[model samples]
Target: MSLLSPKVPALNDPVLVNEWMAVATAADISKPTRVSVLGEDLVVWRSSTGVHAFRDLCIHRGTALSLGKVSDDQLVCPYHGWHFNGEGQCTLIPAQPNMPIPTKAKAFSYPCEEKYGLIWVSLGSPAHGVPEFMEADDQAFHTIICGPYIVNAEAPRVIENFLDVSHLMWVHEGFLGVPEHSVIPEYHVHEREGKLVTDTITVFQPDPDGRGKDVNNDYVYQVLRPLTVQFTKTDDQGSDVFAIMLHTTPLAHRKTMAYAVLTRNYGFELDDKQFSDFQDKIFSQDETILLSQRPEELPLDLAAELHIKSDRLAIAYRKWLRDLGVEVGVA
Candidate 1:
């Protein structure tokens, strides 16, 4: 469809609208969890077969299917007692016990998948597969699922914050990086395929999780998608690499959820609570400062904001987003 074709409303293709976002964890869906992604409410549930996600509203009476239960391999709606099967087809309507369900009664369903202990959904047609973090699937590394942090800023900006390690010194002083050691050496920023990558970063940081020995860490940062970024860090002396995936999901223009997953070989024997606490402390610092950036929307215009040599990654991230035809709520 052309941009001038009747000036029509854009179609919502979950996989194509934006990069995949982790809307819920697999554990969150016992019966069905109501997850909101970029203003679309989805009902995601787990069944004996696999995980399933739908548009959340019942076709019969516009009631939330999430408020209901799963019975006999179908999602039952609370209002008017309508039942939808895994494919979002209306199978049973209690009022008309024998009436055949029509094809139009099907709910708009999304392509949902579970990876790295999180439920990822897309509201657009996806030309590419979901992002890959092989460590999360490999057996050698122990994995810990991190937060569903609700940052009070737009997704693009929150994602930019993840690629911006320069702020760690001031914003996350005691926990993440110290002001005394804030020097960022010149790192070359280049794009591999479609992602922005930089690998020449080395920093002196304490053990991020309070368990490992402090050392100078070599880091490789990658902007996997507009709202997805990751970093792999390995202390110079250790053989283990701590890989983290930081993904931001836009619930709306100004509301976003940050989901993280960490894979490491060092802290497998440590208590899970300490790992959780340490992550919480670090992100709490980022959340406090990110919420205060004015014009909260990410700047696509290169000159809209000033930049320095250390902000090469952030600059590259914004340029990549602009090149992809991405806006606030769409990709």
Candidate 2:
């Protein structure tokens, strides 16, 4: 089947779009990590000097380079004694004692950067820099790094959920969402700098019942392509907004490895333990639903079939992708 057919988007192709991959925690060749972005197998690891990313497959025998070892800032293939450096250059060859290793034996390389406790890889030429923690510099609030999660759905679908606010009453009722008795919220969608930003604000009037008191909250989501989302929540008493940024890199046509960072801005004492606990609860809730979704891309021309006021954000997002010259599947 064609890659971009109605049933599936061309997620594997390198020309589609770029995505963020993983975080850099430690430096050891014995610890090899595999990441999939744009349907390509990316092998990320730390050498003695810094981090490096290369195509996972070895050039000589086609063994996974990620399964190899790191020795003296060079990746040594486990199958054959071929060594490659950070620039994907073949530096050493055990079989050839006198002959210099041919350049053809080198592996394919990708651009990777280590920042904000994460390792980011670019599948395409990304003009915008790697996603940063905006709240980290604010002294009024503490910052936390919420570890990554692997979601089953596509990156766009996962981001749509973060942009959705109407679902709060039903999906996250008891935990973070308002009750059914609360007034329905007002929503607005805007575009800024080739990106779509959504804001949903609801004010909780003084209610006779205490259940609806905390319903007065505002949720704002900013979608920054090719896969970064910022979620902010503001309220009356000492505003606390957490920015959940997601970087989804495609593993295949049906799977993705999603790297997420939750940056919190609480104008009070918020320690690591408290922030970690909060993130754990919220992410655990989201994981259950996202992982259960059908492992397939939604029809590209969904606008022709279903239409709703709440779908405005979804439509705008699809349009933004289309505007970037990405091929939207046929109806």
Overall lDDT per candidate, in order of appearance: 0.78, 0.62
Candidate 2 per-residue lDDT, tens place, 12-131, comes to 433345545553433322466876665666688777767788878887877888788888888888888789888988898888868977758777777788765677777556666776
TM-score of each: 0.92, 0.79
Name the 10 consecutive residues with the lowest summed lDDT in model 1.
2-11
Q: Kindly list the per-residue Cα lDDT of model 1 for residues 1-331, writing each as its tens digit.
A: 3211121113332333756779987788888889987777788987777788887777666788899898988888888778777887888878887888776777667778888889998776566777988777789888888889998888888878888878877887655577889999888899898788996698777666667456778889988877778898887876878888999887766888888898887767788778778888888888887889877887788888899999998888887777777767423
**Model 2, residue 217: C-alpha shift (Å):** 3.0
What are the clashing pairs of model 1? Answer: 13-123, 13-124, 14-122, 14-123, 14-124, 15-124, 16-124, 16-125, 17-124
- Candidate with top TM-score is 1
CA RMSD per model (angstroms):
3.7, 5.6
